[model samples]
Target: MNPDIVRWSYAAASGALLALAFPPYSVWPAAVLAPALLLRAMRRAETPQQAGDLGALAGFLFAALSMPWLRFVFGPFAAGLWAFFALGPALFGVLLKRLQGRGDWLWVAAAGVLWAGMEAARAHLPGLACPWLSLGYAFAPAGPLLQAASVIGLYGLSAAAVAGGAALALAAEGKRIPAGALAIVAGLAWGLGERRLELKPQGRPVSVALVQDESYDVERLAAMTPRDAELVVWPEYQAGVPGGMVDRYREHLAGLTSGRKGVLVVGAATVDEQAPFENFAWVLGSDGALLGRHDKQHPIPFMEGRLKGHSDPRPVATPLGPVGVQICYDLDFEDGSRRLASRGARILAVPNLDPASWGPLQHSQHSGMAPLRAVETGLWVAKAASSGDSMLIDPRGRVTARLGFAGRGVARGTALLSDGGLTPYVAWGWLVVPLSLLALAAAVADALFGALRERAFLVYPPSPLGVEAES
Candidate 1:
């Protein structure tokens, strides 16, 4: 086969494999194979630009295949979004190419760090941070492996996944030592995760009910509320209750908890005299008293018309426990949930809205993030989604109960309210991003220094006898 054709084929295969690693296909091994193939393709590149181009090709394909749901919202313009996300992978390829020729182990380690650094950067980009389909999420369905997120957050898992992939690529090139070392490390992590899963969770068990309805009708949802539940949640924008009607709706919705001891968490909209509408989650006590409200901190850019919430997210004190509320997109990022966990949140209630028009894949993919958040915070997650996939996830990242996509019903489950301290991820996992950044900087500096030395040597050649040539 022609070398260029072979490299292109590998890049294309890498993208396809990665796409399959996410829902609804969810072939987990494909996630590992994806990066390995991309690395192989890049290895064949004669120049950094060619490597970056190959990386971009793989990234574009992965984004296009995995996020077709964007088409429902952006139409043909979704192609532009895919291309924008491709920049991360393109940068990863350039860095990997430059960092090569370090020991195989160091190169492998740098590959993982560079990939993770780029992912962190992409996720925090000023106006366009989309953290969808991260490599770590491919393991979300694996209960034992997912527990690793409790100690290292999603970015750490992403690093491990990419490192494993790089190791695999090296193994394929007949390099066994580094590959075996990484495999052993991965095995140990898995063992620890399984052992962690065996430990019993210490917390107060409270019955929770998630109302999943598309109509967002207050009366309909109120009727569906379970009276015995200690916590009742409705999906985001549950009526888009106008700013002026929030008080009236709160009074009426509180009727759901009339005879029960439950707290009602309803998703709605709020607007002040000066600002436009803000996505808000209302916490109502049993007697119709307003406990607190959390505005959606990370509103979907361009797609959502609401103003970005500026308030710090803290748990609202409830009779059940301190319940933290994260509106749909807020859960996609680490900041809000980690802050809540560090501040002593006992349980998390997420009100999500995924229109059926966006497709079931979108709902499933979005719901997958709940498990990661659950493990990271060591709190039970009660996610109420408008169109479906409302679920209850335990601290171990296990989906205890769920309602399937495109359904209108209530998901009932027990949530354990943590009296424990923040999980390691909530407390210290933030170090992963900064550490990765520092490691990348070192690798780039090493590459530049090596280049500079080579150029200097060429400018002043040494004689065959090891003496400098006379000018």
Candidate 2:
């Protein structure tokens, strides 16, 4: 086969592998192999610019396939979003190729760190950022591996994956000894993770009921009675009251939880005649008193329209321990969840409202991320999606019970709720911050070296006729 054709084929293969590693297909091992294949494709490039172009092509392909659901939400703008985010992976390829050119084992580790930093940068962009599909997310299916997240967070796992891929690529190029050493280190890491998984979680059992309905109808609560529910949750935006109907809405909610001993966390679109509309989770106490509110903190970037997000999160005190309430998409980020946990929230009551328009593929993908939030905060997550995929997840990233995407149903289960304390992830969130700085330094160094190398080969004062120099 032609060398150019082989290089392009490898790039395309890398994209396909990465796409399959994410939800729907979720082939975990493919995530690691995709990075290795990308490294191989970059090795065929003669210059950093060439490596970047190939890397960008691979990234574009990966994003285009993996995020097809973006089309459902953003329509034609999805392609532009993909193009923008693909730049991160393209830059990663440029740096990895330049550093690995030295053939030093140390650079291999650096390459991995660089890749992880790239993922963090893509996720942290101010207004327009979607950090889904990180390399660490692929390992979510492996129970023991996710235990590391409680200590190092998700980006740490991404770094390890990138490093492992680099080691595998090196081994394929005949650098066997170093690759074997990395394998041993990885095995030990996994063993340590298993030990963490085996440790019993310290908490008391709390019976929680998750209600998933198309909308918050009076009949839905009137017809059903929970046997033993310490807390009852409804999906996000299920109760949208008119600007003049706050009093009536409160009266209805009061009636809903009047006799029940459990607190009701119901999603609402609170309308005020004086101010802008706010998305909130109204916390109604057992006696039908309004306990407080947890407003939606992280709404979908473009889809949210004009709805605003709250910056600080406060937990609502309840009989089942302090309960933290967040809406859909907030579970996808670490800040709101971490804040809720830090402020003494033992169980997270998530009211998700994934519209049927988003499709089953999006539902499955969204559900996969809930467990990671549980593991990161050491808080048992009770997620109720209106369309489907209502679930109960423990602190160990275990899905104790789940309802798939299709019809509306109630998910009733007992959750072990811990006394609120900061997990390692929340207490030490600075691990990735420094790693990003190191990656930035590496990229600057590679650019300098590449530029100097090109300068050395430049032909100045081209021919005897005072022609322009060849770059």
Candidate 3:
């Protein structure tokens, strides 16, 4: 809370601002938050030890704030995550201080490698592995920029971003070196890869209709009104609430269809009487009949046993071709999108809802990322956000149209932005292992063997030779 220590708090705010790129709100500009943190860390040392601690503080705040939603799973949520992010980064920052010196570029190099490795660590931490934004998101809107992910995977972009962030900090204080050069090369590679992918194009588009209904009313929609929906869609937890309360919304769903032959995809809190509560999407036929249903695969980390396996993406046979479903958080992961496209999905449908957390920047960020999914899959993805940005995207990561921010009860057309087949990214998964391994190796080496480097003297200065002068 002190003014001097307030810089750490500044780091936390920067992290939250960067997080606007994720769900509920999709503002990507929030990413500029990182550079501020990098700037703070690149400075004269009060003590090599203290400087390292500061760097660690910056890293932890960045990770923790960016992942505040994680508190929902741990229970008694809110503010508890501060300790985790605040105290956590101290360790790595301590290590970073050992590398700082005049004309030293390794300080930033180590920072980027360590940061990327840290992100990879959180991503693989089993119960905590949520790839909220693996750095690849920065280039999501630049369609050709992420084409390199097809071969190297998301971690490549993560390493590149880390290196870029760290190198920029050092370059501002000093000059360029391997770190800056590597970052430039990585950026160029993405451009080249994107250009190569551009040569191949899918044929045709599919017509789609997404329902942004608000009938759930903090309770079960089925139990609330005249049951009648041959085809309709709802948001996460909108159809059922307070447990075992879905019977109420059946009539509301039925009414949306009115006996017309159409697809009804509902995002609701689903209960099957005898089964455990689930956040599910119940797909209906042209006449209010059940066709196929898919549960969300990647529920928010920690919000499991309830929303667990609720956001899995899968394709269902439809007249417009096999339509795919990628619920709210599902689109955040590249695998879900790749899997659906691999399975012949030409029209992707994401039935997502975000009411409590809403902002203009947030919707724009989500819309920006949505097209990356579309272009990668070479299919049309209608991201229907009940309270956020509902958008239509084509195969080239281009948005045809989008619904505004938190537009309650607003319905609009996205025309038919569709295409066929799949991109190389869809054909490959976990292909980024090699790059991840390299980054991990660099991190481990620095952590264990950095004491032998010349920069160590800056952190732990050598004793001065003293000689007594004769009187």
Instruction: State candidate 3's TM-score.
Output: 0.69
Question: Model 3, 396-416: lDDT tens per residue?
Answer: 566665666766543333334
Q: Give the whole-model CA lDDT for all candidates, comma-separated.
A: 0.84, 0.79, 0.57
Q: How well is each residue in 1-471 modelled by candidate 1, as lDDT tens digits?
A: 899999999999999999999999888878778999999888888877789999999999999999999999999999999999789889788778876776888778778888888887777776776678878888898777888888888888888888888888888889888779977887888899889989988777889999999896777888888878888899998755655676786777676557757888888875454557778888988787999999888868776645765549998988887889999989988778888998888898999999999998898899878888998889889999999899998889888889999988999998777688778889897687788777767766776787789889999887576454532
Q: What stretches of model 2 exceed 4 Å from their correct place?
A: 216-227, 244-248, 271-275, 430-438, 441-471
Among all windows of ten consecutive residues in candidate 3, which has the lowest summed lDDT?
222-231
Residue 276 of model 2 has an lDDT of 75
Query: By lDDT, is 2 or 3 better?
Result: 2
Off by over 4 Å in 3: 1-52, 60-77, 82-114, 124-126, 140-154, 170-202, 217-234, 241-259, 271-274, 301-305, 310-313, 357-369, 409-421, 433-471
Better of 1 and 3 by lDDT: 1
Q: Model 3 Cα RMSD, Å?
A: 7.0
Model 2 scores a TM of 0.90
Model 3's number of clashes is 38
Off by over 4 Å in 1: 255-257, 271-275, 438-471
Clashing pairs in 2: none
